[model samples]
Target: MKILKLSYFVKLSIFLILPFLCFGQEKEQKEKPELDLGGALRFNYIYSSWKEEQKTKGGEFGYDMFRINAKASYKGIFLNAEYRLYSEAFGGGFLKQGWIGYKFNEKNQFHVGLVYVPFGIKQYNSHNWFFNITYYVGLEDDHDMGFKYLHEDEKWEYAFAFLKNAEELNFGGDTENNSSRYSYDVVGRNKETNQFNAKIVRKLGDSIQHRIGFSGQYGSLYNIDTNKNGNHYALALHYELNWNKWNLKTEIITVSHSPENKEGQSNKIIKMGAYGAPYEIAADFNMYTIGLSKKISVAWGPVSEIEVYNDFGYMQKKEKEFTDSFMNVTGLLLTAGQVYTYIDYAAGYNHSWLGGNFEDDFSTGNPDANWEARFNINIGYYF
Candidate 1:
């Protein structure tokens, strides 16, 4: 009789507290946040037609970069960041992008910190590894210290941002803006400031889709020497099409800058820098770009898919005395599990990163510049 009474008492105690225990577990699960961390390692092989020695040696292979990506979310708050490490000759190591955001609902959100400028096409404007000519001019994939508000629905998307300045390298009190960064910015005596951007996109169709977008930007150019602010503005119109396994992109952009520089300095040219170097770019220009791509699925071993693309870009300077710049890239992308590779044949005329000298290629380009070509292969492993 005593043993039966003891067993009954224990069973009654567990039954009385079981509901509270279940409730607490459910609440804890709901409060827990989600986190994801990932990274990539990449390498490159190059055979430049302009580099005689490299071409004679059958090209060169080297380490490209290593990068880390992190993301976290709790309730309606989220964080995202990426950091990259490159060779010392490049920009060394730097934070690519980082932002904290809050979602009010499914269609509205706010972001702060270093955010991408809402300009041009979304994400990348080109399918090739070299991107388009707009990237070198700081009009594509550019990021700044800013706050952004975004709204999206089934057929429309809109974004507005106000950027105080570009990302600063905080070394010391007299730290000068340098080219040790991932994106191009005004890095000499002048800095970008008080920039505002607005963008809207209209989406149409489902299986065969079309997207049309318009973007506008205006910013102040703060010259340290003059201590007076100048102004710059850009306008862009872009279109994208997706039909089955084929995609197409095209854009037209016009940009102009009026900077308050020191005496005797040319206002038609501005100093822009990135990847450990500075170069001059024309202050007023028009750019045009177009790209087409087709995707194919494959059953080859360790290779699941392939995409073939061709991208072309042209820049025309407002100053008639200055020459023009153009680039064309034919490439294919291969994806297999965690590995991705790009094989590209790129040709350019008066392009900065191709073969022309960096100082004036994008400013007063060389009229006698001949076409230069580079065959490159880049492979990356992602986790």
Candidate 2:
């Protein structure tokens, strides 16, 4: 067995400190503040029709999230805050987005505090509550304590962000019930001190539009050694086509990571699952997600529209000993009034987070037939 060497207070100060200083300077010169208040009380229910357990189906119903958002602006200094109370394993309910932003003009802006990492396409990754496989890889709603700068124009977009503590905000660690899980960082679940992300996007076409961007990440994963580092980078392509009442969206994302370790520092164990053990991450891993979805207006009573989507993902380590993983999901999402419903069927290796705990439950004695099925419906109400 190979063991991987496992690789804060000043960051909170840096994240919140400079923003407040700028806010204070602007606050004194501002005359009046504009305030806006809004929120959503969402209820979610899930019924799992079939899974790996060689047994009965599963069902769960309860409050998914209760969110409250507030925004205020005075003399061009803006503050946005949101908090959530959520009961979900696929996602967490915590300071969703709280930031102070300054708009230099119509095309440029700067923000600080907890903000979005501005990585993959939102539609493909956010089709359902599970948020695709990227969320488990720390690219979906993966907010960090940092500073960000954004510039957008009619045809070009540019962004840069410096972040602290990668995948530090995580949910779901219990492998006890063989639960399908959501996480902040399961693959590279460590505090990254110097994480930087940069991307430049170009828009092509008039109506049938395509947007492409090259992105890179430079970061260090620190837990065991304060000096050892891990690095990863990726490139993404997103496309959107719009018609009168329908639109098509698709995205392709590929990422690669290289982990380094010194001997004897591999004592740290992974927090959960059958994969949990002395983690040796000195190898390279590559993963990709490809997704396509179309939304059409269906004038069926109160039903506003319907979305049809299919997403696929694959991951494998460069080394031959570890297993390769993948998932195939096809589903329909229905929007009626302020509520949204998802009917999805997923098939993949037992190693998929959206599928059943495959390593724990084996349908066939052979791992090759470890394929599993999950048909689930998630209904949520917004208020």
Candidate 3:
């Protein structure tokens, strides 16, 4: 039985209004006024430990998800706001951005309340929505009602979003209790979903970069109600080169997830499940990763440039759910002292965001393995 179609909100609102009706003509601008404020201050400390074969636990912490934001403009009409603070006590901070914008210039623009989803450059998905409660850590701080249309000219950049949320939040923790009890019925329960995402980025001539995207989500799990629906995707390609003092980079990412569709948009109830479970106990899930980065500069004096990175990926559990399929490999080392002022050291191994090989509870079957031995240091100062 297959009949999953809902026109995905009219094909993502006609791909964000056909690029504003093929560049919705607009010209003439003489007025210009500005008062854009800025704010930033961050401090974080973490210590972790773990052992699997014999069982061991670990911890160490220090945090400050501090933030301050401000914005105001006249001519293109703009206004922005922010406030965040979270040091501990269940980590709660809020108000990350306030929006009000109008601009059909510099490429294109349109805005509406509480914004932040500034595609990539990494923040685990453009820093995860928004909020300004002292940069709280309870979980990406909810709040999304949606409307975005963006264009970055120079080589081509695209972004289209139509979001909605009554509820859904994730800041790590809760992968079905992390295994045991027959892998918790083979992994189940952490649901509270609602998502719809789309993205595209391209620039392939001078150094190369490419990305394609997708997103789908519908809630219910935490506390169990079972209306579930989830689908997420990605396709990636990248390359960066700069020879003179040496600099090179490479990237590849492919991911997929689909399952827990309990007759959503039914055509005879395509309840779906059992795809071998990997990728969080899939109804369907796939993964791929490859990374390489290198940078070298400072020949002598003022200590700078020295970076190296490596990554590998392989994951399993989608062989129709019988289980047993895993692979992960990773390595990273970094050093960048002078300019940008810090980050004197950084290290990693099996660094995960999807490389630890399954077991984020996969809905509850209990699969666990997340290895890491990382250290970072920074002395902060930026005028």
Candidate closest to the true structure, highest TM-score: 1
TM-score against truth, every candidate: 0.93, 0.73, 0.24
Tally clashes: model 1: 0
Top candidate, metric lDDT? 1
> For residues 1-383, what per-residue lDDT tens digits would candidate 1 score against the true structure?
99999999999999999999999999889979999999999999999989999988999999999999999999889999999999989889988889999999999999998998899898889998888888899987988889999999999999999998888776432345778888888878788889999999999999999999999999999888888899999999999999999999999999998999999999999889888888899999999999999999999999999999999999999999999999999999999999999999999999888997869999999999999999999999999
lDDT, each prediction: 0.92, 0.59, 0.38
Would you give me the overall lDDT of model 3? 0.38
lDDT of 2 by residue, 1-383 (tens): 12322214556667879999889878775657889987877554444434333234345556656778899998778998888765545344566668899999999999998877777664236465455655545555666678899999989988899987433334333111122222244232333457788877787777567676666666765533334565655556655555553445455566555444355534222212111211122124455666667788889998989988787766554545455666677888899998788888876674434444533211111244456656667776655
Candidate 2 weakest lDDT stretch, 10 residues: 270-279
Clashing pairs in 1: none
**CA shift at 257, candidate 2, in angstroms?**
4.5
lDDT of 3 at 34: 65
Q: Can you write out model 3's per-residue Cα lDDT over 1-383, one digit (the tens) per residue?
A: 12335567678889999877766533223345667655555443333233242123232334444566678788778887776665434235555456687888999887766544433222231111111111111111233445567777866666665544321223343443221110011124433234444445555544444443332223222322244444443344433444443333333333344444333432111121111232333333343333344556655565565554443333333444333222222322233342332231222222222234323333222334444332333222221
Q: Considering summed lDDT, which 10 consecutive residues are worst modelled in model 3?
A: 126-135
Better of 1 and 3 by lDDT: 1
Q: What is the C-alpha RMSD of each candidate to the true structure, in Å?
A: 3.4, 15.8, 23.5
